[model samples]
Target: MSKLMIDSFRGFRSFELRCPGHVVLSGVPRAGRSDVISALARVLLPESRTSPTMSDLWQTTITAAATGDTEPGKDEESSDGQPPAAAQRLSSVEPRPYANVEVTLTDLDPELEQLFEGFLERCGPDGCAVAEDQALPGAPWCVRLAYRLVYDSDVEALEQFVYYPLASNPTAGKYTRVPASTRRVLPVVMLSAGRPLQLRAGSPLRRVIDELDPAAAAAAFDVLRSRVTHAAEELAGHDAVAQAVGVALASGGVGACLTDTPLDTAQVGFRADDGSAEALLKSLQPTVNLDAAGPLALASHGSTAAAMLGVAEAIMLATAPGAVILADDFGDQVDTANAEHLAARLRASAGQLWLSTRRPEVARAFDPEELVRLTRHGGERTWHRLKRPADRGRIRAMRQLHTQLLPALTSPAVAITEGPHDLVVYGTVDRQRLPGAAPLSAAGVRLVAAGTGQDGGIGEIPVVADLARSLGFRVIALIDRDKAEEQTIKQIEASCDVVVRLPSRTAIEGAVLAGVDIAKVRAASATLTAFLSQDPADGVPDVKVVEVVKRSLHKKSLHEPFLDALVEETKTPPPMIVDVLNHVAAAASPSYSGPAVIDIPPIPLPSAASPS
Candidate 1:
């Protein structure tokens, strides 16, 4: 899927979202993520019951309907050859604006490109055009399909259809409906919340049945259905069932004859499941029984989800060429480890995969470039895609995005720390300051470690800052007052909105340890030593106690316990230390006027400029 365009559809008045195949959408609740999934279903999957209702019509206004009292023009002819509704009402009704949802599909395999040859058009900087027109030569070709719902004045109801909208401005063009036969080539499967893979009707079994020779399957079904029905008939004809049914229906005074034409006969009998042979295939359910344990269902959700994914893959979706699978609230039911495992497998199963989730781990399963951030404010929705070059997650250098810094996708502001130790200290201080509220997380702030000034840790701040800003987040950099290089500090300043430095010339260790009483320091040191299972020596030298505290600060494994003890022993936090936390914590605003992150255009297709 190359692009999705929406206008006057659902909650979106006008929107455009373009991303490469296999995306992970993350956003706050009620941010229209589900609406996007619904839009895709309406256009691509006929099985989806997204029929347009009155509520689906979004552009009608009370004033427009009332003032259209004078608009009973000749264009008010009925859709058929009948009289229009406007001819009867005292005041004319204004036509509702058209609701259009269009999807542009590219990256077609060789066979599909041939199948949709007539519909293909090259889209480029000047816009889309056929080769004969010579307007879009050398541009990449794509096929655009859409669902349009329009209000019909004659019928006084909404009408909708999915069609090949083959025109530069899709709203114009002939109404060429995409027939059911052709739609099989572009099948869409929806996997949403509370819906795990099952073996019942509409499952993979049904799809496999449909793929078999239709006449052969129908013929076999006819014989099996007749045998089942005949057996049911025999049971009803038994002396017991007929007598019971007759007594149940017959009045006390009347004989058991039910029909006037037939003598001493009843009309009721058992009715087996009845439908066309083809339709019966859809009602068939497959069951699995393992050992003595009967199949109530798959043993667990993980097994069921995994089984379904395997079946979907077994169908060979890549062979279908244009199959699209949408997983809304993806991995909501699975555990973190399993969800990540499922995420990777899910991407490989289909030609295009679209997943949305509130869970951070599921989103992290894909590369950061595949992550799309969606936000809604003041009844408007926008989508943001990362602007980095198309690495497709191969470069493992950005591992922080896969772990500690993952929350930045949701945070409105982030405090980029110089090392892992700084995170624990700053995080503890933020928690202490907000005693009445939740920590930085509750306020939508993230404290991310840039690294320990080794292995591309501190130097990664500029990259991380750029990424956070690309997702519409504010960046605040926290570095040691003395240890950072002049060039490294300047690079961070250029990318981040705020840069905070400690007062001491040393790292956070010296800055946090300043102006503390010696006895209190020794007490904190004993807390660390006792926790480490070391025997206590009576009256250890004061200089040696300081050395123990400094050594613990350098090693990450020892920082947590010592820091917790120090925070507890020292009643008063240093004022300079508190100021650094203040700068990082200032990012959270209860009511946010969103940044212009939506202005980031989608990444263009390789060697092909975006169409106008």
Candidate 2:
């Protein structure tokens, strides 16, 4: 069975945030994106907390609120003694008839605000402060802005419970707070891009928190003050984490490229540099609960980095292990690099991070293993989950196309040589030099030979080798057998893969004469030498056949001038020259089977190519 499988679950009828970490829901505006976010908020927050006017009562109350007839934050009495609120509080309650998603805003981190601000600027309409005008048609930009601004501020209050150590102080009207445990939280703040932010810190949430923990209530304001500094420092770094956020904020949509602006690593050390570092460490951030009103929160304004950090603060506080954050239209303002990094980071830090986005760049950035794609069919939501192997295959295919076909299609592969003769040698011997078993013409692999026969020209071999490797090719070195030493072999091997040294010390002249009959030359030399010098008593040659041939070739005209030219030029016998040619001869020999090892004469190394 294949290691990859596509899984689709259809039980969820509308939109739902069944888990938590950081879920971003993004798609073409008005594709029920905001509706999904709203649905998620419905799931996470209690119906009591939701504005009643925006719920089942929506049909009757929406018209009134739109016309400013219904009072904002107006409440009714409930049996539980809590005020009956709007079924959903989007900008203080009113039903919006657009698509969106619901999400959480928790644990605000001020340090990452600047980075998040960049993200917002990138997503901002006409590139300015988030205003209601920026929300696209069918999405309530104004209400979303105000609603989340209020909601995020309330959520930020939650962190005070953890950050400050508590002590009872009856005379002070509140408890004294000191430093507590250095809790590492991955905050996920919900935000909307390009809209006014008008959240008041003194919203009912403050009262509610005070009712829960009066001691924490007094320290809440101080926490917010500290977070502002934290956000400032994170804005000052150059690191991958900050860069990822910056990339997301500097674009029109969530998927964009990583650019040169780096995260400032100096300001926010990875380890807790101080309480100050703690303030700036908003690692995983995203905008959630997006709709027209989503962008009203101050946390949602400014750079993409600032906005994403806001989201990160919310997620860190809201999630636990095995929680699934299903963010529909989650990456509406995310850049490609940031989206990818955020997705991978969330998956690593949390149980499951499910996001909905329609950007192809986002789809491309995601690993096939981690992607869960959603589409609307017959008014119902449908999705496909990709497994690891399928994702891996997709990535591999992309890499192959990028490295190989793109270059060839753009420009022909050029093989630059020192001179025309080098080109000739490359053209003539290339086939023999590069065998089909060792093909080198797909993407990054190219071959260049220096046929000029100049010793100084050989210096380019290393450069060519590097170029080939960079282009993804294995280069094989070929040189003449001119009294080569072991160091020559090592140097060539160090630069390239396979090295083929030419047979017969005469260089190219010998190979041309031998042609395809190199075996004949070997056999004839062996026979003549055995005939000319045989042991009188034994009537047999004591030396190996190849050794006798080498000695004969040395004595002949091919030896002196060829050896002198090659050895004096490069200063070393090209290692493996005779070895490769002999192997070739043996392969073509009648007695050949598989890889036959041919015995050849051992030649002394020349003093030239040796290390100084």
Candidate 3:
């Protein structure tokens, strides 16, 4: 079975985004935006990979408590009769982990070669690089370029340091920087909030750390107190700096030093909620302003912080060569214009990006072809690539057919079919002809019943006029020009388009179901009447007889039944018969320039037979 891995990064075989593209992943929450980004991060940052991912951030206290009491040799505890030691040892053994994507700098941006060369040279020969430097004996060394962050954090930023081989020659104990010539490029991603101000950008942690002594860096974090303080003073001494600082403080959950005292604002703080960075990025909410001020005013506190992060992602992409970026939700809700600005920044960024969105207008903000929609089928998600049309006239025509033609025909309109199938066929055809076209059902069209009139068929005329008058609707009708239905057709001309009349008349039911054309209907009665002249025991002859110059010419086996029926019916016919015979002609006759007619001389209306 061929399947697309849509919900998780672990499930994909090879991830490929369309080129010169921007992907718009629009799915409900929990649909896996973070999973995709996480996979991408893994591919870009393979060196610093870890089991139970992001394990470096876990506190020592929590780690000690979880593994503290377990004895190294104890196999006492068992699951399914298996000793716990086996599981413990299995977990304890440090299995090497690899990255999700093996992205190289060359794939993203070539211009960053100088930047990478310079970065590698600065590493010195200590070989302090984060990962093992093992390539063919002597080759162009490369650093993996990959980075990720739910919100801006110094720790997340430091990952870049360990992503590449800082120092080389692990086997010889000579760890030093491999020259700048061989380094890999990486991706940078920054996730934005979905609801309201949820990212803790300007927190007390950074400030307190800056104030602590070198040795107190660890204790300062542990003893840090959270307090709430109004932000008006951050700008007191320096107007520009304070305004920026004050706004960052207002985003919530910040403990500020008020008059040399720390104040923790309850509204905002680092996510105290339990979840991985992936989970946090996926669920983060946008900031809302309680103050009636527009979104910019409402987002006063954290607005600057969030804006700076977006700017950083742009700058990183622009500065780094061949780097891809995946921003989950880059713009806040109320400030759409800012989001547009962000999109412009992305266009100028170094690498391609895959942006998921719910806004249809987002396409207007970027190149039209760049937008790809995420759609669902049954239980799976799929991408729909939108292509711009080349012809505008065709689009206009389709629009008119759907919005105008279809509505007028279906609404407050009467439909008259010569038979049941005609009704169904017309409805089906009409549906396909409209824009956003919906199929027409029987219930939608009022079929005006033709009374028990002999020869039950109401030629086109009465069907059209009566429908227009009785139903007050635009009427469309199909008429059969049986051997004498001309008069009936003339009456319908006033109301019907009368597009085409079937030359080889048959039951409308048969025409509808068999998908047969009326222009070439073989006359059953005429053929049967002609065969009667031949002996029943003998086969009919296949020959064409033409009366050249009006001389004696005969078609073998004259159709007798048709002549007899016509002769008998001429004696007793309905009022419409007079009109039918004068205007109608046989379909088989050549030179059928006029509409289908019932030219059979004065045929009496016979009992209507049920469709065969």
Candidate 4:
């Protein structure tokens, strides 16, 4: 198997993808899943210089100091303290926006050698000045390129070049045009989200045919044509598809044929006597059917057929045996069963299949290690490979819940609370008081309950934090100060980007009690007491106040009415709750700096007769 490593490539800061097996990439939309796939294609097939429509080349402006130059000389400085002509020109050298892509081929073959020879020749001492020094040694069987873009003003041209890094030199290396021969070694087949499995020119079907054995493909087409012709002749019933065309026009009316268009390429199309059949026949382009409502072209069939066709063609065109197959949102249009079946087929095929999807069902079909997640935080993109947990069976048992519980894994930042009650409390306060501010989801942050304390104490905190970090999420473990132990807190703080403990020996319930006004608490307690047919006690302790409110609002859920009443009556959250919310918002916000030590005043111990 070959391993591909990409650094500072488009949205990817650093990542590695191994080939020759099924790998699923998933994340929230616009998290750079497709960009990685396109990067792989560009690396393997260096002839492709332009970026895919879904992504663009990553560009960055470089200051002169970054390129090993000091500030402009005083002689070159203008009287206004501006840089001199020469200083201004050299003040900021763009260094040509670039990305680094490297591939390690385990077993070298003649074809690969030929490809490497061409690549090395372009990067040799005679070519780009940096190529020879930056070229990889033979032992590793690796090819590395610093792909950079240069603009030429005289010619009004912009071009891309691949440079080899020098061993000790940081600023210069050999460079050359992207090697054109790498395409012959490994072909990349990419299926984007919007790409349909149509049988038109430049469509996936056409590309598949072009890659397969011409004679075999032609033979298959003839057989399919004959089958369709036979089926059209037997359409006697008043079926929707047949009735739309009145009668079957001819025996060969539904023949599968190729048309030579002005572009000088053969386009696959089905021939039908009546034009009405065109829509029906086009829908089933992968099959030899004249009926629009046939099993192949049904509403449910379109997605499945499209997915299957791409896989089928990939299997047939195993020209580059271990070719890299990239599909963005692989099963977006297919049902769960069909998507899983397609995934299984790809797993059993010859090439390495990389698929990206947002569907949990599709993600569940693969093992933890086979899944790669992308996340963006603070304007930086990171990739994570899921690792198999020691408690694999426990994870499997909770698979359904885990899938629903961890929406935070897809978000850029996550707030890991102790349990659902805490989640609801904090979430309620955030929504009610800071509605106009950056909400969790709007800021690309998600609040995840890390399982209740009854489940396993705080053990799940480290586990969940590690999992979130592995997927590149900036995590803030909001723990109850009372429940946190010194060692456990230390471990969680080490694993997460931020660790925020609720104010002194208090949980969210305590924080709410300390934050909301006494009058609002009494009113909410009164409302609950009336509903529960209980008398309200005077001078109840803060702890008792929280317990009464909790029980009264059980039927209605605690967060909303209780928090709402607090906000409405008090006009603001208490200091403690506000402090906790501030920490959560900061951690979730993209502008968050780093972990901080927060000081929160201790909640005074409850008086006698306080509820436990």
Most accurate candidate by TM-score: 1
Check candidate 4 and list the clashing pairs: 129-174, 130-173, 130-174, 131-174, 134-165, 515-574
Clashes of 4: 6
lDDT of 4 by residue, 338-417 (tens): 77777666656646677787766666666767777877655666667765556884474244235423444456777777
lDDT of each: 0.64, 0.37, 0.37, 0.59
lDDT of 1 at 69: 30
Candidate 3, residues 544-612, lDDT tens digits: the string is 111110011012322223223322333221223222221221221223345432222232223222346
Tens digit of lDDT per residue, candidate 1, span 80-129?
96445535344333335678888877766676678777888776443333
Let me know the TM-score candidate 2 reaches against the reference structure. 0.26
lDDT of 2 at 190: 32
Show the lowest summed lDDT stretch of 10 residues, model 2: 1-10
Better-scoring candidate (lDDT), 1 or 3: 1
The Cα error of candidate 1 at residue 165, in Å, is 3.6
The alpha-carbon RMSD values of the candidates against the true structure, listed in the order shown, are 13.2, 28.9, 24.3, 10.9
Candidate 2 ranges with C-alpha deviation above 4 Å: 1-31, 47-49, 52-301, 315-328, 360-366, 377-381, 387-612
Runs of candidate 3 with Cα error greater than 4 angstroms are: 1-15, 27-31, 45-323, 349-351, 387-612
TM-score for predicted model 4 compared with the true structure: 0.62
